[model samples]
Target chain A: MKLRPSSLFLGLAFLICGCTEVTQIGTSVGVASGTITQGQAQSIKRSAAAVEKTFQDITPEQEYYIGRSVAATILTTYKPFDQEAATRYVNLIGQTLGQASGRPETFGGYHFAIMDTDEINAFAAPGGLILISRGLLRCCRNEDALAAVLAHEVSHVERQHGLKAIKAGRLTNAALVVGTEVAKNLTTQELAEATKAFEGTINDIFSTLVNSGYSRSTEFEADATAVNTLRRVGYNPEGLVDMLQEMQKRLKPGSHGFGSTHPAPKDRIDAVRKILGKPVSIVDQPVRKQRFAAALSKI
Target chain B: MMRKWLVVLGLLLVPSAVALAVNARMIVQVQRGQIRATPSYLASVLATVPYGVSVEILQTKGEWMQVKSLQGQVGWMHKSALTTKAVPMSSGSTTAKTGATSDELALAGKGFNSDIEREFKAKNKNLNFAAVDRMERIKISPAEMQVFLQTGAVKPLEGGVQ
Candidate 1:
């Protein structure tokens, strides 16, 4: 006997209702329907449950692994800054902002590194590996201003803008292959296909983060989020304005890094000013300034 | 038959009942997190929780989750800091039947892991895994952060939340 569509709806409702005996119900429905075999029904149910179709489907651990490779790739282009003290200070500030932000934790935790390059850029990899150029550090007039820059990068990771850049079809294909493979270990051919998808995923993130940059709207979102994150951490939101102002002064034609990737610094400053709703005075505390100076003294 | 319908109904009800009975548990997926006394990050930290530690979810407000640790400490953690997926409890008990589905496994670092990273690295020799390794090694302890906050008069210790 063929099962009615109404019965199918009921079955789906049962599934949504968190029925413990889903497999049994699915099998019975399939048998009653006379349209598909029990095995096909089971396979479908398993696939539905097992698949990871979008960027959101990527596990924190998977993101961490992806971030590791991405960071590695980035390192190939720039060496780590030689000053240990400066690196440590950046981590302290980054971690402080991270804890205060909406997302404090990533799978591997947030790590901050200084790239030795003079390029004025910062990148936030998928998991939490954030790299800032010494050139960007030079732009910061004080600790709070530096905090603003780190907060912006942290916001990018928090929003998963890099992950979102991955083409939808790539994730779908990866999920399909992974969901269907029931074996504990993938065969050689299966491994090869999955690896290719994995590489594509990495390439997508790298291009968005380092090469092409995110959309202007995303950069603005990061700036907005950075303001909130700065405020949450007791740093003055005006630091963002100050940093943007610094960037605006330094901007030149054909400049690479932030200048190339982001909208005009003037536009960003205006956007941040609009978000803050009023003029904010810079709170450059003596102690903060001293600490910031001491950290960068070696450089 | 009526008996079959009853069985289906029972099956449907059992899961909901089980779901309701079990207090929601979340594992700390981040490397480390603070259990704050209040929902805001500016609240005093009640405890420090590390990765894979399961906490009973008490309540949720916005992006924060109030959770109770195994030692009876209660505090708020960011929802981003925890995961609903259950991980294997003991590291040594490898084959102990985690009861996690393939989907959960796929999401929990089961398939795409260090091995894949190794293979990817072998293929791309120019990629600097060594630098990434060194970057990962730069860590700040919670104690160090506490000292930094204290010294710098940072928030969470400096009074009101902004």
Candidate 2:
């Protein structure tokens, strides 16, 4: 489905044209359709796909290096678990889930930990680093709920969603293709240009990237991955929905989510319901809830 | 005549202003030893500041260098402590040139050495964004101080967020 972007988005189309009279007329004529017109968005998709594919073509070593950088930045912004037991326990759950993921033995495994807060928030950096908030912990009545969040985040990393979003939402390549191996054979000068391109895309649409967030398709992909993961681990997929419904109730009328970053939770929750329409079979119990709660209590 | 003047001016300014663009495999000799602050350090470490790691030679204030790291982590170190080579290796790569530049940058440190190592690794490339975002949010909401506690790695190093 095409995204019906905010007026702020159409205004950006105006920015692409030269600031001549024609530019003014073109921008005025452009409108925010619920979806992109075939002409309007075809180029965007092609450019986004090319850039995204190019960005990931760098050596795996580079991926690890960049991951480390992003992870370090996260640590600066968020505190790690001070308590050794809690830290170790969170890591254990995370690693177990990581092992269960389709790609078990990544060069770097997933790292999850308890954030010392009461906010119902969780974040997964571009790498495997995942942060589960203390506030969010209170809402997770079962391990299924917790696993659901982590699995969704894991899918994001494996699928390279951030890389795709960063490439797609904002990037202006030259009319020329520098080379097929743009990312791989980048010289220092080329690297500088590439980094500038990287920064430009982020600077232009970081708000939309952060606010409007991932496309509904990516969210659905993550959700589907979460369900598959739950089944593999013997957890009921229904717990994901239960947790999401609770999120719906807990969120203030106007203030949804941690923010309007993800697709609406109610819509997601409904999708989950429709998928598991009858939820008839016996599924894994929320046995880990008490242990999870007890483990979190110390923080 | 205008072209002649511009060429002369560019040549004169560019050399002395020597970009010292952290060229790969360029060895720089350190003149002294001194404590340098690192983002990768939560608890201060008594490290042997190497000559090799000093990417930029800002100036000699007495027997030390006010050097800058690739990520903009700047600190003063005594000339006696650095080797004037590249940054000291927690391990350094004695490999080929050109591409070794990328390798050397990669060797900054692993989290295994210190929690700060992990922090540096986690926040690389996006350091400026993360820093600006966190700093601005903290300043705006004093009551939201609790959020900082969640995000911070440790208590203030030298009193403030600097």
Interface RMSD of each: 3.5, 17.4
On lDDT, the candidate that comes out on top is 1
Query: What's the lDDT for residue A126 in model 1?
Result: 88
**How do the residues B12-70 of candidate 1 rate in per-residue lDDT, one tens digit apiece?**
99755754665698887665567987786546777877555678877677788778887
Give the runs in model 2 whose Cα sits over 4 Å from its true position.
A1-53, A56-59, A74-81, A168-191, A194-209, A280-290, B1-162
In order, candidate lDDTs are 0.76, 0.48
TM-score for candidate 1, please give it.
Answer: 0.80
DockQ for the candidates, in order: 0.29, 0.02
Give the interface-residue alpha carbon RMSD of model 2: 17.4
Q: What lDDT score is found at residue A147 in candidate 2? A: 64
lDDT of 2 by residue, B1-162 (tens): 999999999987764564353222223322112245432112133333332344455544544455655445556443433343223232233333334553343333221112223333253544533432232121111122223222322122233321
Cα displacement (Å) at residue A94, model 2: 2.4
Q: Please report how far candidate 2 places residue A103 from its true position, in Å.
A: 3.1
Question: Fnat per model, in the order given?
Answer: 0.52, 0.01
Q: What CA RMSD would candidate 2 show?
A: 21.9
The most accurate candidate by DockQ is 1
Across residues A1-299, which tens digit of lDDT does each residue of candidate 1 receive?
A: 99778477657767676543555465566678786787787776656554437787776767788889888988888888858889999999897787677777777778899999878888898888999998888888988889999999999888988889988777654564444223255556656666777899899988877778889999999999998888777788888888888877776756878877888888898898899888868767667788999998655
